[model samples]
Target: MRGATAWSSPIDPMAAEFQVPVYFDYLATFSWALSGAIVALRKRCDIVGVFVLALLTSVGGSILRDGIFLQRTPPVLTDPVYLPLITLATLLIALLHQHIIHLQVVDKLVSTIDAIGTPAFAVVGMQLALDAGIPLPGVILVGAVSSVGGGVLRDVIVREIPFILQAGQFFALVVLLACIVFLVLTLALQVATVHAAWATIGLFFVVRTLTIRYNWQTRPLLRDEDH
Candidate 1:
């Protein structure tokens, strides 16, 4: 991707693109927090644990992203959107827990939400890193790590290997692909940032869908116990 320098142009395409892919960041947080709450509740965790887990899962990524960028304290903390959303999703899961279990639709919802959430992260992470003037490789690494950072932390705290490492899914690949997408479009095509964001979101999700559909995963050779 063409690097956005001080003299690149008065217009900033990357800023525009940031807005487009950002919605997915919101959705991913909501779903991740909700999912954690559901799991915690299912395991009979206490009320405080439920809330803590929910917040960590949902807003964790953004907090890390914003901090790295030296942006304002995250809106997820001050804004009203996340708290209520987490609360509602958690309560609903708690109330409907029994009925939802063993329901194929629920399983599908979980899987779809998880699959969709992954790529949404890739765009957000890559964009943030690029905006911060990080190198592409660093941006890619940061993107992948930020994209799934919260989930990985949540799973570890709750005692589960994150989906990225298992489940035959190309979790990190999604973020890396997203980083490449942004770099290529911004640098090579010099496409406006917002348009690039739309493309990134579309492509990332499509790739993630294929990865899930085909059970695409890192090679088993990478899974040795000693590694």
Candidate 2:
């Protein structure tokens, strides 16, 4: 108790209308839409499918976050810019489909974009949860959902397993770690919210990029006898 960090005074709900920076939100939205559109193209989807996937992957997480947890209008609906951003992503994929598919850097480009968007959305969701006065566990949950919920929807629609549910790179795990680190920094260490968010995002990006570079993977809890 002697060494415990003092909890900050309660935040006023009215004053708690926290916002993720416009640039961060829009950049992440576009990156995710681009990733989704690429996947749609790889699956041989038509232009309509590209748009559908782009829209879902760009906004599905925020939809789940607001509708289920925050219980408010999702920013994709309230903000005028989000849809246009997704449309731009779709158009880019539409016009450059052949070039993108043939580029040697496509994999690396998608990985880089994913690394950026994942932490960005996680931080955004974590901030929203903190402003809403949710419990710490709920905050982590919101962050993970906001990071991967869109990909889950896209995968399901395409009849493939969701990345979060699969034993692959540390996607949801990284998000959870990021959210926990943010809470520890802001709540326990008393760091400023913006600084803590940036630190967490940086940490997540570094760890995620390293894992991808090294082919670090999660193994099955129970291995199959055939293997």
TM-score leader: 2
Task: Write one digit per residue (lDDT tens) for candidate 2, span 1-227.
Answer: 11112124433322322444568778888988998999999899999999999999989999999878777678788778899999999999899888888886976877787787887888888777766667778888998898899999999999998878889876678888888898899899988777887788889889998988898899888789857
lDDT leader: 2
Candidate 2 runs further than 4 Å off? 1-19
Per-candidate Cα RMSD to the true structure, in Å, reads 4.3, 4.7
Q: List the residue pairs that clash in candidate 2.
A: none
Candidate 1 runs further than 4 Å off: 1-18, 21-24, 68-72, 222-227
Q: Per-residue lDDT tens digits of candidate 1, residues 1-227?
A: 33356223333434634465555656777788777776677667877778778877777776776555425355577656778888877777767777876677876676577666765666666665666566778777766765677777778878888767774667676677777887788777988766776687678778877886898867776566868
The lDDT, on a scale of 0 to 1, for candidate 1 is 0.69
lDDT of the candidates, in the order given: 0.69, 0.82
